[model samples]
Target: MSLSETQPDAAGARRIARPVPLRESVYSAILDMIVSRNLQPGQHLVESELALMLGVSRQPVREALQWLKNDGWVDLRPGLGAYVHTPTVEEADQLLAVRRLLETESARLAAQHATEEGVEHLRELCRQGFAALEAEDVATMVALNAELHATVMRLSRNDVLVELASQVDRRVRWYYTPVARHRGAQSWTEHSALIDAIAAGDGDRAGEVMHAHTEHTRLSYLEQQNLEKSGADAGSPARPITGRRP
Candidate 1:
């Protein structure tokens, strides 16, 4: 039977429909693996192995890899096959720069538009994030952190800004995941200040606080990368800041 086409049943009497296209299923599985860091940066993505792991055939896996390549999640080497995209410093910088611009505007607008209830929602997310941090539950903390930022963006009441933020949102989470544990207490502390600025309806202050807050995360990631590289160059084991692979 052709992998991308439907096959007849043994009796040749019934048609079975798939819930989703095989290629899309493969694509989602692979992307989830990438986002979860199970497929680490620069890791080889072998189609046969991926197919086997995902319980699909190689044809779907191949198609999914092509899609992933187009989406900047995979790199198809001319001769060496596909690998997860290892983001360059330039790429990271450019993305984060754009993120800062969008989020700064969002924060400023959020301050102008935030209702008391909206501010309280942010506060609740902040509290949950801090609690997760204290418990050393990095996953929950990261999720809560995302929720807090998303709430602020929503409170901005600008659909255009929200849409733009959504575009880079997943990639931002991918970049943020590795360092979430490291940011810990300090991140939530920044959120607290941002919440205060928003609550006070200080657009300028809110923007300034968010700008600084994001820069902190960007710098933290860069610093950690530098340390890892230094360790490698010095012939020492490169210990991750998070102490465990995400």
Candidate 2:
């Protein structure tokens, strides 16, 4: 349970402040690790280890695991304990398809309402993204990519769209991480075109560019998954589809 303190202010309005629940914080930490693949999919989750890793107690870890299970982030077995949920190909495809729809609409709206500042912000991000790419900084590149898309969503001025995008943000990042490097130059190039369309206030062209941009990513992810499956079937060692940072 979460506790908060309420006090009267000068105008008699109440101000309440409370720290986040420990279980909730633990849940977020574990969820992030899972999303980053630090806790690989299907990896067994040891409550004690998690407690130790997070500097918390077993009770909180246990609570967090249950919450994670409720959220489809983990699976609790009858006797085998908890494990990270391994998403199926269908799960990935469905999620990406939804993203494409939401983001395409966001792009169109952003073009309609984009300010000079917003477009410039996107250009700055693209510049940083290109720098990250050239330096082989995979983590920065992934983060900037996410930021750029999120910026576009915000520029749309559609609260519901932004909230919807936030809901799948983690999973989208999880899937994108494996293809970030593979998408590389071409991905940023698409972003430049998207920026141009939005900057020009060309809603139709912006939607078209964003549609192709997101679709390209979707296809790239699917292709990588297929390649990995083939390689696995051929008795070859698994390879990282997105090459590691140099």
For this target, which candidate reaches the highest TM-score against the unseen true structure? 2
For candidate 1, which ten residues in a row score worst on lDDT? 237-246
lDDT of 1 by residue, 1-246 (tens): 563356435435555665998899899999977876678888899999998899988999999999999999999999999999988877887888899899999999999999999999999999898888878887787778778898999999999999999988878877787888888888999999999999999999999999999998888778767787788899997553332334
lDDT for model 1: 0.87
Misplaced by over 4 Å in model 2 are: 1-14, 240-246
Per-residue lDDT over 1-246 for candidate 2, one digit per residue giving the tens place of the 0 to 100 score: 323333325334445667999999999999988876678777899999999999999999999999999999999999899999978889999999999999999999999999999999999999999999999888788889999999999999999999999999988998998889889999999999999999999999999999999999999989988998899899998764332563
Please report the candidate that would top lDDT against the real structure. Answer: 2
- Which residue pairs clash in candidate 2? none
TM-score of 2: 0.91
The estimated TM-scores of all candidates read 0.86, 0.91
Per-model RMSD to reference: 7.5, 3.9
Residue 116 in candidate 2, Cα distance off native in Å:
0.9
